[model samples]
Target: MNFKKKLSDILFLDIETIPQKEHWENLSSKEQELFTQKTLYQRKDEITAEDFYERAGIWAEFGKIICISVGFFTGLDENKMFRVKSFFGDDEHKILSDFKDLLESHFSKNQHVLCAHNGKEFDFPFIARRMIIHQIVLPKKLNLFGKKPWEVPHLDTLELWKFGDYKHYTSLKLLTHVLGVPSPKDDIDGSEVAKVYYQENNIERIVTYCEKDTIAVAQILLKMNNEKLLEDKNIIKV
Candidate 1:
């Protein structure tokens, strides 16, 4: 594959999430108890809708969106470069709404690929769910529903690393280390994002973390395409 052409059709994205607050308070006592129980277990498969709703509610209150960072890399000016843009939102609804619009406007019919690290399982679905909640239609090009697993056009860095073993699962940070991408040295792992966002109102910190992850994704893509991975210092802030 021509690296330049492929890069032109790629967009890298990442998001930051926090737990919901007011929604949790609205649940009845039994529902609240279920939520409390599920929180203790942290097992999605064993939970019921009531439990899920309560958890989603808890996430909704403190569940502010810290960032929706994206990178659009394309061939331009006879030079290969990537343009990075990020959307930061303290308001979850508005942030997700804006992200949908941004994606719809940029989406094209040229076989572009939406790239993310572990996006198929998490980030992509989260975005899709938020769009549904906001009554926003996803761009036609991004409709991954019901597609065969192999036929799905969206590329996941983590998925690619499996490399036919199908049993090894590695975090993006580990892949970054193997590929020589500098870790952003972020203090907060994703599990703590909700706590930090809600309890501390630390939106900026989360945004920074999201940006770092986006950069890491871009670097991984560079390695996949056999290109000299550019340092993320060159990434432009959106």
Candidate 2:
């Protein structure tokens, strides 16, 4: 398979979110009591889904995009290089605004096909909602909501690996492991991101974690294309 044909129009994307926790704490006494009652756990030590939902709203506060990292990979003659650009800022609104700016002016203009692991379910919808909340228009190509499944150019790595078994879902890490991609032992996982964001307020850490995932996604793409992907060592901060 020709690498050029595979990567002719491709952009990989991922996002990190911190659901609304502070706002949930400000609920009135009556509301709080009702929420707690509804979320009571079956086991004394277990936390219920209700408890989590009551404590944290479904959506993060507008503008607090902990991380939104995107990678653009293409072939130049016989070589391929991926440029990963990111958007990170202390202010949630500013972070999201800058992300929207890049999507509209820089990323949105690219003709490349978009790819991600579980992007269709998580990243794409999350970004679309954020764009709508900010009133930022999505790029012409990315508006895949109403299109026929075959008409959409975006690819979800998780979806690709299911192979019609449909009994289980595979995570990016699991796929990378099975495919023999490089695994960094000290990499930050998503579970630790919210704590790192609110407790330490470390935007850089979040960015690094997000970048690692983007690279992992890129590696998955390379594997799918039956092409070799060189490791990128350059660290980007934005």
Candidate 3:
């Protein structure tokens, strides 16, 4: 399949999330009970709700986004570079608001598209949910209430790799490795994100990791189009 969208029209991004609270015990009695009910099926017969609490970051109701790193291609052909910027902090509202501002100010056009590895299932919906929680307006690219499927200005590298196969799932790391792109998981994996955020208190480290994933997504898109990956000097962090 041919890719019609121009590289410059795509904004590649990745997000890092952690459980709403550092520990299960920090939740109130009612909240704890609700969490127990929420995970009853997933935690059945083996683990208690508290034992499975660390996995809460995958759920929008129990999780909060701490970092969102975005990258965009600039220039043409061999002269292109990927410029990355990250919005992150302990304050979820501020982080989301900053990202929202970026979306509103620049990427709100109908021709622009937001792309991620598995954004449709994870990053996109997670951002929208957290935006609602923060009472921020959903940006045009993200607000999909009345838009048809083809009208949605969103792209997923994983979905593009799927072709017509719905049962297979390919991870960004695995795809990058197979496609001869740089691995973004050299420092840390998703499982360690919450620990790094809550225990290590290293927001910068998480931001760096998130930025790496954003770069990887951009590279994946380039590789899919039979284009060269960006050199180290061509990747700028802001």
What are the models' TM-scores?
Answer: 0.79, 0.78, 0.97
**Top model number, lDDT:** 3
| Residue 35 displacement in candidate 1 (angstroms) | 3.5
Q: Order the numbered candidates by lDDT, best leading.
A: 3, 1, 2
Instruction: Please identify model 1 stretches exceeding 4 Å from their true place.
Output: 1-5, 22-64, 76-78
* Clashing residue pairs in candidate 1 (N, C-alpha, C atoms within 3 angstroms): 19-59, 19-63, 20-58, 20-59, 20-60, 20-61, 20-62, 21-61, 21-62
Q: List all candidate RMSDs to the true structure.
A: 4.4, 4.3, 1.0
Q: After superposition, how far is residue 236 of candidate 3 from its true place, in Å?
A: 0.9
- Model 2 gets an lDDT of 0.66
Top candidate, metric TM-score: 3
lDDT of 1 by residue, 109-156 (tens): 457678899887777777777666666676654567787776566878
TM-score, candidate 2, is 0.78
lDDT of 1 at 131: 65
lDDT of 3 by residue, 1-238 (tens): 5677888889999999999999999999998999999999999859999999999999889999999999998999889989999999988999999998998888888789999999999999999999998889888888999999999899999999999788889998899999999899999999999999989999899999999999999988888888788999999998
Question: After superposing candidate 2, which stretches have Cα over 4 Å from the reference?
Answer: 1-5, 22-24, 27-46, 49-64, 74-78, 106-111, 233-238
**Better candidate number, 1 or 2, judged by lDDT:** 1
**Alpha carbon lDDT of residue 165, candidate 1?**
73
